[model samples]
Target: MGLVGEVLLLPFAPVRGSAWVIGQVLNEAERLYYDPATVRAELAALEEELTSGAIDEEEFDRREDELLDRLEIGLARPAPEN
Candidate 1:
């Protein structure tokens, strides 16, 4: 039954392939987002931008808060299986 459905959808294979690729990209992006090291690197970069006056106080505060929130959520979640 599943094989028949795949055969029927074969003509739209490229579309399905594109969707699969997009899903993979999204998954990787999410994993990277919750990564502690990545979050720390972003925090350091944010601080650098703020100190260099690349970003104003308001922008820095908002982004800093967002990053901190991510950190908190990531830490609270159970560790993922390797």
Candidate 2:
């Protein structure tokens, strides 16, 4: 946008900035969520929880399935456009 356009939108700066921040947060979150290392770490943690009796078998199975599904779906997604 030109200088004149920016000046005209100055009053909406806060809203635009908020949207930018939200987009950044979402992007980062997706990056971490799909990371293979992250998924492995979570699976290890879930195993520990089960071992220590922090979670029951049913709960552990449910969570493990969800994590596995996320890993699969994350990998299956197409690369984002630059």
Candidate 3:
């Protein structure tokens, strides 16, 4: 299948494993796009999910990385070093 076909077929990939992860990742991006406090709250919830085994370590790690990336993009930066 072509890349577009593969992409279109993604939703049917039997990915019952990542329902919450999809939500979490989208929530992270949306919160980062809006409010830092909301992002922090979402991250806390993500951590809770990880601790409670609602999300496994690998999924946690992937979403954590994505959250951190969004956090980095959302955060303000200091002046450039000379």
Candidate 4:
């Protein structure tokens, strides 16, 4: 953009910065959410919960399915570039 265009958009710089920050945070959050290690840990915890009767069989099944789905999706994603 030219100097004139930049000057015109100067007032919106804060808004643009905030949007970029939000996008970064969202991307990081999704990366963590779909991380295989994290999902596996959650699955192990869920199994412990079931064994202790902290959760019923139905709840265990539902949560296990969700965790497996996350693991599958995470595995399917291409590795990030260095």
Candidate 5:
């Protein structure tokens, strides 16, 4: 299904399905941030969707939060940054 379809279906979807969707989205965001080269492009696309009203502000903030958290922990180096 397309993104709009997924968004529309998210709320009404089963608990497990909603969780799965959230997880999938988080993973994608993680991927984008772990690689800076794609971060700007990917985030810009998400931002565009938000600006165009394709996604609500709450959803945008939730996803953005998840992305930042994942980048902080998952992408962290073994040693702390200087």
Candidate 6:
């Protein structure tokens, strides 16, 4: 953009910056949420909860299915470039 264009858009700079920041935060959150290692850890914890009777078979099965789905999806994702 030319100097004139930049100047004209100056008033909206804050809104643009906020949007960029929100996008970055969302990307990072998704990366973490779909991480295989993180999902595996959660699965292990869930198993422990079941063994300890902290959760019943019904609850364990529901949560385990969700974690397994997450693991499958995470594994299917293409690795991110550094």
Write candidate 2's Cα lDDT for 1-82 as tens digits.
8999999999999999999999999998997898767898999999999999999999999999999988887788777678
Candidate 1 lDDT tens digits, 15-82: 98999999989978887898888888999999999999999999999999999989887788678777
lDDT of 6 by residue, 1-82 (tens): 8999999999999999999999999988998899999999999999999999999999999999999999999999989789
Candidate 4 lowest-lDDT run of ten: 73-82
**In candidate 5, what are the lDDT values of residues 3-62, reduced to their tens digit?**
998898788779878789999899777555575445445668879999999999999998
- Clash number for candidate 4: 0
Clash-forming residue pairs, model 2 = none
Candidate 3, residues 1-82: lDDT per residue as tens digits? 7999989988877674477689878976665464655567778999999999899999989988877766776575333235
TM-score of each: 0.70, 0.75, 0.50, 0.95, 0.44, 0.92
Q: Considering only N, C-alpha and C atoms within 3 Å, which residue pairs clash in candidate 5?
A: none
lDDT of 6: 0.96
| Residue 8 in model 6: lDDT | 98
Model 1 residue 18 lDDT score: 99
All models: lDDT? Answer: 0.91, 0.92, 0.74, 0.96, 0.72, 0.96
Model 4 clash pairs are: none
Least well predicted 10-residue stretch by lDDT in candidate 6: 73-82
Q: For residue 13, what is the lDDT in candidate 4? A: 100
Runs off by more than 4 Å, candidate 2 = 1-6, 78-82
- What does candidate 4's lDDT look like per residue over 1-82, in tens digits? 7999999999999999999999999988999999999999999999999999999999999999999999999999887766
Worst 10 residues of 3 by lDDT: 73-82
TM-score of 6: 0.92
Candidate 6: segments with Cα more than 4 A from true spot: none
Error of 3 at 76 (Å): 2.7
